[model samples]
Target: MFEYLTAGESHGPRLTAVIKSLPSGLEIEVDKINKELARRQHGYGRGQRMEIESDQVLINSGLRNKKTLASPLSMTIENRDWKNWKKIMEPLQLETEPQKLTNPRPGHADLAGALKYNQKDLRNILERASARETAARTAVGAIAKQFLAEFGIVVASHVIQIGNLKSESWSQLKQSANFDLDSKVEFENYFAQLDQSPLRCANSEQTKAMQKLIDSWQAKGDSVGGVFEIIVRGLPVGLGSHVHWDLKLESKLAAQLMAIQAIKGLEIGAGFEGASQPGSLVHDQIYYQPKTGFYRGSNQAGGIEGGISNGQNLLIKLAMKPIPTLAQALASVDMISKKAVSAAKERSDACAVPAASIVGEAVTAIVLAQLMTAKFGGDSLSEIKRNYQAYLKQLSEF
Candidate 1:
């Protein structure tokens, strides 16, 4: 099984992640991981902090000569802003007084976390709750992506909706075509086109409109959020089992997506829309060919049925609520004064759907990597490949 844990405050000297149980002998590419960290920082309407920080991952342990030693992997990304916050965030006692945050931001973890931990200063809660932690997760996911790539699995994401603006390409695909209408080759072309977009969106018109909304909201001291879709391709059938509820693929994917800050909703394939339709319209039709084996004509179930992969492109969409930290703060009560006050204001993005889309891809990759490892057990990449190839051969025979 694959698992990871992260440690660090938002303004701490560095963020750290420890990932374990990765198969041995898998090549590690520092540049590829750094590129993912860079992607996590890209997006329109990002805060000034993005400009101050150039995130680069340092692999402190687990690899020897750029290859995994089958041991725990440890990584870190230095927080450049730490220089300015050293006194405030320093671990040891300081001569200077610590900045105390009394007013909690609405829609953030500040108040809830502070109350739960019996903290007087909200900074104690907000530091770890900040989205900055996603940088460490992105680095971990980059490893999962590399591992999955060894088996031909690829993950990608694009913003489908931003506030009131929705991608026309997504609308077209949902309304005009069967879920399986596009071949893998065709989808790759679409992904290539979206990758060129500033917001990682497919439609230029919608993206422009979203950018305008972001600008308007920023000027108003507000923030906005929207939806992004994640797609995973080249997965073999039966990665997840229907035998146990916790082992279900959809369940695992949902938990991971919801863990990201501001994400409020998740959909798999035609999800909520399918709920309103009849079984005839919602269920994918099955088909089989001599060479292709079993397949689906549509994928309204999102390449998963009965909690198992059905050998089609996995589709998922995430909905993110507007970030809580606003320049024009919302109403709240001061923890110390016990009086009505405005919410705390902090440096934050007006919109982060584009960047969240990348994080979504990363998390999804990690889940799929876990499922793949579980299904094809091995302590080394070569052993896993051998096992997976045998499973493929068995499937072909079946």
Candidate 2:
């Protein structure tokens, strides 16, 4: 039910997002959405764009008195830098023809998108392809996050690797600390503190090393990418179905997480590593207790088994490639001149792994919200909560 669409350009007047459906009576705070937007802009290696744009959501419709009305929610984030580009990016007629871009950047949509759309100017392809549109998705996800929180569901993420430097993953941290994986507050506190870190990494030594790596790469006119982990707590079992391929929870999460720009790889729990181990060692063994109901000693399955949630904290990891735009442009052939030329260099980050982690959290929240609404159908928040409580009772009795 939390389906949404986003539209905007990197340097356009504004970005827009429309959430098609949501339960009525869900309270939404504009400041919370703005907070998430600000979180997206934080992190080292960000470009001038972050400085130029202080993103905040402007609600257009589908809300009354800060509560949902079960209608479409429309929002916009004004691009403050649009003032400088108005002449070139004007929607209608212009007094003079704007300079057309012919060079396509490596590892970007410029070439393929232009070929598919039959456009000579690469800007036509790059504007929408830019990751700037994720700001709108972040705004939409902020609302979904609030809705999830009402049901005790929470989502968070932290960067684990940047360039050659690596830090502890969620599972690794739990094991090292002999942590209680079931403690929701501990999980929240741990990831919450990461927001203060420049790289959003837990290890101070690794964070410093990663920062140095980014600086080294930037000085060399290169870019770097890394990995992050996402954690979701307080999810109920059976939100997804085992009967359908598309209905599988991991499939849904993988599809959305991989769609984030620059994301090149994904792993759920012991993903690739588990494949190399024996089944006896890799599989999570089952256990039961009167207080906790069905449980597992390990989470190698990432909280989902047989395409349905297993009531454990959901774990996901994503790998982002180096940002395509670089200070030292790569060799490319100009589309118009049909001659070798340097790739286009846009204002970009030297490393964006920390920022991408926030986007990962937002996307994960959106997917879980969609599945939650699908599993417990209702038109209002109270109705959904009742259904959710009933489901918990059923699980307890089983």
CA lDDT, every model vs. true structure: 0.89, 0.91
> Which portions of model 1 show Cα errors greater than 4 Å?
169-171, 174-186
Model 2 agreement with the true structure over 1-398: per-residue lDDT tens digits: 88999998888889999999889999999999999999999999999889988998999999999999999999999988887988877777866898999999999999999999999999898999999888998998899999999988899899999987899988888888766656877777787889999999999998999999999999999999999999889888887889999999989999999999999999999999899999998889988788867678888988988999988889999999999999999999999889999999889999888888888989999999999999999999999999999988887787
lDDT of model 2 at position 19 = 95
What are the models' TM-scores? 0.96, 0.98
Clashing pairs in 2: none
Positional deviation of residue 141's Cα in model 2 after best superposition, in angstroms = 0.6
* Candidate 1 lDDT by residue in tens digits, 1-398: 56999999999999999997689999989999998998888889899999999999999899999999989999999998887999899978876998799999989998899899999999899999999999998999999999999998989888988888887434357566554435667767777777668889877887889999999999999999999999888989998889999898899998888999888999988889889999998899988899878877678888899989888889998999998899989999999899999999888988999889989999999999998989899999999999999999999999
* Cα RMSD, each candidate: 1.8, 1.0
Model 2: worst 10 consecutive residues (lDDT sum): 177-186
Q: After superposing candidate 2, which stretches have Cα over 4 Å from the reference?
A: 178-181
